[model samples]
Target: MEMPSLYGRVLPSPPAVDFNSAEGKRLFSEALQGGTMEGFFSLISYFQTQSEPAFCGLASLSVVLNALAIDPGSRWKGPWRWFDESMLDCCEPLDKVKAQGITFGKVACLAHCSGANVQSFRANRATIHDFRRHLIRCASSQDCHLIASYHREPFKQTGTGHFSPIGGYHAGQDMALILDVARFKYPPHWVPLSLLWEAMNTTDESTGLHRGFMLISRHTAAPSLLYTVSCGNESWKSIAKYCVEDLPNLLKAESPDDVPTLLSHLIESLPANAGALIKWVVEVRRKEEGRPTLSKEEKERLFLKENVLQQVRDTKLFYEVHGQQYAKSCCSCSSSSEEDSLTRIAAAVCCQGVAMLSGNLASRDGLCCRETCIRCIQANGDGLKTVISGTVVSEGNEQAVDMLLPISSPYTSSCNSTVSDEIVNYPSNTDVLTVLLLSLHPNTWLGIKDEKLKAEFQALVSTDNLPDVLKQEIVHLRRQLVYLCKAEEAGSHVPPSH
Candidate 1:
């Protein structure tokens, strides 16, 4: 059946050509028979109609994605097809595409996330020769396919701009086949080499970037992970595939619980990005332990100002993740009871201090949370009980109740602690509070061999307001017990979880 189009209805014109067919080639041969076709490849993909006529770019991308054998929530093997509606719903919503068409970055990112090898290049006046060469090279490879973006005016076509695939090239005719994605709007046809080149050189209005071609190949090695996820479970492999793509961004999530992780992958990914995390962590410790200096006023001003913005960022994330419901805003915090404040603070330490620091924290980054996330672990102590079943700790010397030290720096410590005795569970009389504090906030309890890591970590742990129970434990252990600086610094983000 014939399709309706505005171009034919509004003006006198011949039917648009579909070069992939025999009749169209006969027409091309009769009209512009300059040379025999050197290379030919074609994948007939349908055009889109739902969003706006302007969605030609998306339609073209959908075509490329399907041809590359990458799953976009569906079957990979195809005589190839791109359902624009499904693509929009899964990744770019329709309204978003309508407002400001997609970018090559977004398209490439989608392809990359789908496990395709994507190579893109923008065309310039001098680069056309190289582009032609690359096109021929790609045409020879079965796994390779191309998406081309060019303005329509140069071709004297109906639309202003469009995206389509260059299915075949004729060194003989010096004409390239444009497998137009808007085949419903304009039939697939051949445009002269010079005209197609001119069209690609046109600047796109949306991104202010010149139009170009992106080559996608499905056959490639596995994407490199900074570190391997240790799980042999297939379900976990799926989640890890989805999670690692955004792990760095997840690290900056507003709250520890905002992007919870499974205790499993957390044990894996933490080591890979620990350095990036500590970069911010050291700053947090510094701000919380800020002190008046005996140095000149100039030095002090710079020191305080350096961390001002970082402090705001850290606190913003903390409060945003645990807003009024759990940790109230500064204005309303004044009315909360002291007990509430202590409990909330303790929860924060348990979460951000250990879980987040060790990547034991999580959010729905696709790793199925086993209710061991920071929010769960910090919920009424029951969640934590499952993990810290080894032993209990006891309160000790009552004299150290208020031993708040004026910690000067994150790396330097005047005090020291070694095991006061053998590694044994806390005594039967050990306070429940002490056991909870020790087990939950063990980042400060594990030891470190790296002197520099130990110092920076020691300073942060020392800065924490030791609850009376912790103070009693510290005094009882004669301060011999060490916390988790080395455990985390062991060059892996995964700490030893009980």
Candidate 2:
């Protein structure tokens, strides 16, 4: 007669078959030594559905066989158990199974580990503590960073020691720890896992240094979301692939021994846009509720539209050129042509200075020569002939000219010529002269004692040829000089001259 098979077909009993006795060694041998893949899968499937006692018994047997399969001194032994634990837990162990029976329970939790959940992680204190310890041990063996969970009260204040435990640790290093703390009771499932991976893989560009893993409740989220691991700036693509792709694969893997391999893949895949990726992930977590889910195309479009990369690129250009002062003066004489304020002021001052110097030189040349003496005297009635001719004669005659003629006469004639010149050049060089004269004190020229000078200045005041600007300045200066002279006369011993 044919022997019964564990699954499907039947075969003759092997020499080791002992159906009456339930032996751990025999069962493992049957599972592993089974020739076909069908037998192996059937055995595992049957083991998963068994009661706690039966499955635990089988688990113990599997453990022994696993140990014997590897050399005592090999590094593979510990890792093998870790792997078995993940697989057994995921597939439903044939051994003892805890029956807290939370909604979606272990199945959902395992699915979450594989990046299947949209809600945030919110485990009880006991669960969080247990998960943290396991993660720490596993990460340590693989030379990965360990992170811890931080918990605090909701809102009520008890005593100083009062605190409520929150979410558990995801990943991080010694210096900085990443906490997978929940903001709301129902966070989008991918948030916790994404945050965890970001904490683990972020690297700093400056020192190529990595930071400790960190996570805080939404209520307590840090101002900055980016975390760095190694010094170089990793790209967003690398970050997304490692955190979403590699880390999820790590959790679903059958052997704990594969942890190092998973970690190696993650570290090697660090992205160039790691910082930006972290920012995007955190932003998603925060705004996940009200915002519409972004499609891949929409995300790419928005990212490019915002032009963050372009802004970064343009920073230097903006500071170097566009930031400079481009202000221009809008004064009347600055040629209606737009120019900087400083440039306009400088040009005006320069033009005024040149005109004043030229006028002074012309007056001096005309007054000193006998040929031009009459014309200079008529133009600037300073008695230039008397002043200059006296010098050519004896010194004795020069004193008579100085004493007889009033000092005001020559200055008055110069003032008259300035007034007349303004009429000829109004709105041009006249405007320049008017501005200059307006800036001078009238008393300096008007106070001269020379009779001819006084007469000439009086005549200039009477000249109808003066431009409006020159006329206004002369009137203003005359009033000011009159007030000053009156004040001086009042204070002096000399009686006022009518």
Candidate 3:
């Protein structure tokens, strides 16, 4: 096996360290608090790790990714996960390269293509002082990370271009807090800004571009629908083959024991907002009647659409790269009766995370993800009403007469002749659900916090003419509301007088 050599010289050292020392422990504690770089030097939640021999660039990006809270798991308390080298290596664009290591340009390209917000700077045109001043300002908060790229050889390092997050900068001492991702080899320490700048000017053998810096900023965009919700997309087969077909290995569901762990990890990785949104969607979806079943022709056409296939590919790659889990071992699966069942379950759980994070964390019907759709409608002296465009009228779904009302099962078998007709003719269940959700909070879908409003909504659940599916959903929702109400009462909320 040919070993990695820089300038044809040998440097014997482990590629990374575990950071198990007392100082290492303290740093880890500080980082979890979301480290800072204020008048003093610190970076809370500046997640770090060891790098694979030739995966320094991938590893360094991972640190920046977490520090900027790019992944949903950044807010997690227990041991959190970040994108690993396996995921970065899985990139088809980067894989086509003939070079031994990733290039600076390629890393930036990959990050941007993956929906990561990034801004790069080259040392060739700028002075060290100019860069240092910027670093001091940007590093003042945990929302940005300065990924310094310089030649390691100048600093007596083995590699040509090395990358790590400059977590903190002390202007007084002209020192930079290097949160070295190559921890297996060395722990993080402060370095002279001038010396590090000299290293940045070194040339990279792969791209031939001078090594520089990139600040991975907070990813403000929501994950998109195309990136999640396979929802019987025909192109899913090819997408599975190309991108996440290796999910079994990526998620490491090698044994049955792994499934529960993977499940727990996936749930933990969900942001609090995403969880609330999911609950709202599932509840609202339960109220609707008849999902739009795909016809043979429409299903066949969608299965083969090039655009759909590409979407599946993007969604698959997105999860592998940004998924916050310890083991990338869940997705690898082969075609068999038993394994197929597990694969479907795992895929659904993982992909849902993508959907939840995206602006799509919405109604179960996959509608009303935007702020514009949320409108507040108050109740009258008689009862509640849905006011659309300033007019009061019976919505198609809620237009059912008392005779047509019958609580149905959640399963499809519950759809009877009367219900099926209503589903086809009055497909306004989602609109009604949308109004209900809007009533809670138009600005945020976190949850229904209004105890009095929730109490009033409970009356609607008891209507004799309500849909069975919707009623069952209300039952579940009431449980959540009960919990929320109790929590508020027990905590600090004061009840308002009528």
Better of 1 and 3 by lDDT: 3
TM-score of each: 0.42, 0.13, 0.40
* lDDT (C-alpha, whole model) for all candidates: 0.39, 0.25, 0.39
Q: How far off is model 3, as Cα RMSD?
A: 22.8
Summed backbone clashes in each candidate are: 22, 51, 33
| Shift in Å, residue 470, candidate 1 | 41
Residues 132-251 of candidate 2 have per-residue lDDT tens digits of 444444223321212221111111111111111111122321111111112112111111333333332333232233222211111111111111111112233354344434444543
Report the Cα lDDT for candidate 2.
0.25
Report model 3's TM-score to 2 decimal places: 0.40
Clashes of 1: 22
Q: Could you give me the TM-score of model 2 versus the true structure?
A: 0.13
Q: Pick the candidate with the highest lDDT.
A: 3
Candidate 2 residue spans exceeding 4 A from truth: 1-77, 85-105, 111-498
The all-Cα superposition gives candidate 2 an RMSD in Å to the true structure of: 42.5
Q: In candidate 1, how many Å is residue 241 off?
A: 23
After superposition, the stretches of candidate 3 with alpha carbons farther than 4 Å from their true spots are 1-46, 72-82, 90-99, 223-498
